[model samples]
Target: MTARTLPGMTTISYPPKPSPGDRIAVISAGAGLPGLLPRPFELGLERLRKEYDLVPVEYPATRKMGSTPQERAADIHAAFADPDIKAVIASIGGDDQITVLPFLDRELIRANPKPFFGMSDNTNLLAFLRNTGIVGYHGATVMCELGRPGAMHPQTADSLRAALFTSGAYELKPAERWNDINRDWADPATFEAEPETRPAAGWTWVNADRVVEGRSWGGCLEILGWLLMADREIPRDLAEFDGGVLLLETSEEMPSANEVFWTLRNMGERALLQRFSALLMGRAKTWSFERPNGPEEAARYAADQREAVLRAMRMYAPTTPIVFDVDFGHTDPQLVIPYGGLVRVDGPDRRITVTY
Candidate 1:
């Protein structure tokens, strides 16, 4: 979320970029799935070295499953403290990152700001970094994006490269094709080729008459709810969100359409929905291993999610500009959204640009 510029307070900073041949930290800040499933993790590491031309360094808890919150926090400290580590990326998202928040040393992370890349439950750290005046990336986790079956999505690779090495304005485009379903990671053949995909429907825009430019906030809706419940990171004064752009996405767990409505309704009750000038809703992920639906069922799921969001907005923030199905969440070919960075939503022109 955007931090207020108090007198004498340092302005929000985009952490230093990492160049080719520079060192980057790879930590399993959530579930240490790398220890349980080595194939995808190894593939991601190879890509970090061969494709990105950056050295990948792992911490003690990076691959250790069942590691304590203190252990994970220690790894984060070690990564940021190292002058040689130019950036940090999460191996994958998990369910319990909220627990690790209490153990983090804010002073250490603030002292050595670095670009951190992750999404989903890693939203905890992303919000944490923003409060410390550092911008964190909202997508491109190692096992999910970097270790996608076969080659990485060209769009994902290009966006990540820009975020890593450059500092400028970059446009975000809708994916021509996208995939939400994935094969079992335990299967040896899952990594032999790319997963199947379908044609993209592009984005749907509401309130296309005005432009909204502001600093961005928000993340996975479920994680944000947890943060709100724990009373952590979120500002006590709702004014902290005024004129901000809200970025939200769902995970593979697939909360029902009604659940989505209820969550946004809670935000509205707290006077949170009306503060943002615009909302960027990530493409809804429909299919999952537990409920593998056919094409028709998947399409219905996505439509339901869109309608649910629209219903909530109509009640809470009727005039706010919202663009749906932007490719940046659980969907394949994800874009790296700059958490707490400036985003320009040109509704009249149907374009989005983010300052890296």
Candidate 2:
């Protein structure tokens, strides 16, 4: 493992990528949504084999709804220790992954570092991996982006392909159109058709006068807040984050504008906001079952959240460069971002690239 340090932070290692023929472990480290809704999960497995050419191995508790934290941790241990399993991925994200952290054998994982791919509630494990000096991926789960209603978005598939097998700089482009609403996974008809999407307005830039390149950190804001509250994997020395790029996104819970502001405010209060040189904010997910917002309302919600972010940045890290509406969070056609790996945000060129 190779280590790179950013100011006060300890060094983080980027684990080697797996070959095409390597085996990948798909575990339900969070919620076992796979058991309740099997169509998307099974489709994702098929894609991993035929589309990506990687054999996916599942654990005992991968689809168990009421799995204990220790059970989940055991699966993680098994996946990491086995030499044949070259990588690990989460089946889906859920609410209680924080409980599994304490049960993890950190030394065991660190000794045999392998790439881990996940997001949302899986943020818990990603953060844990980061602190262990191993980089993890922050997007592309089995039952979500990979198993979309119609098929994997071309952009998402391309991004996942590069992140999975290649080791080089890959430029990221905004999808000409994007989807935020998804069909009911339980309904078989959902798999027969594609989700609806609207045209994209492209990315919005702030402080676009220069370029900033650094290792990536941060994940789902709500989950990060939970980690901070529980005093989990966050570094005690604030300067560790200096000169790093921050990756911030929200989940499907659709937090209000005020909630977004306060979360940033809390990070600012801890002096965490000023550490990063740039921020990559994922496009806000505006629609959900409980909050079935119309187009106008969804637009307003996104606008409000953007304003909230700007407000927080101005109050704290006034000069930090920020790129908004990166297609990597809860939205459809998501891009996979490397956690604790290198990212180049070229403001003058209006481009973003990640090293796989």
Cα lDDT, all candidates: 0.91, 0.91
lDDT (Cα) of model 2: 0.91
Q: Worst ten-residue run, lDDT, model 2?
A: 1-10
lDDT string, candidate 1, 238-315, tens digits: 676789899999999899999999999999998999999999999999989998988999889989999999999999
TM-score of 1: 0.97
TM-score, cand. 2 vs. native: 0.97
Candidate 1 lDDT trough over 10 residues, lowest sum:
1-10
Candidate number of the best TM-score: 2
Error of 1 at 316 (Å): 0.9
Candidate 2, residue 268: how far the Cα is off, in Å: 0.3
RMSD each, Å: 2.6, 2.7
Mind giving the per-residue lDDT tens digits that candidate 2 earns over 149-242? Answer: 7889999999999999988899999889998887888889999888878999899999998988998889999999888888787777877788
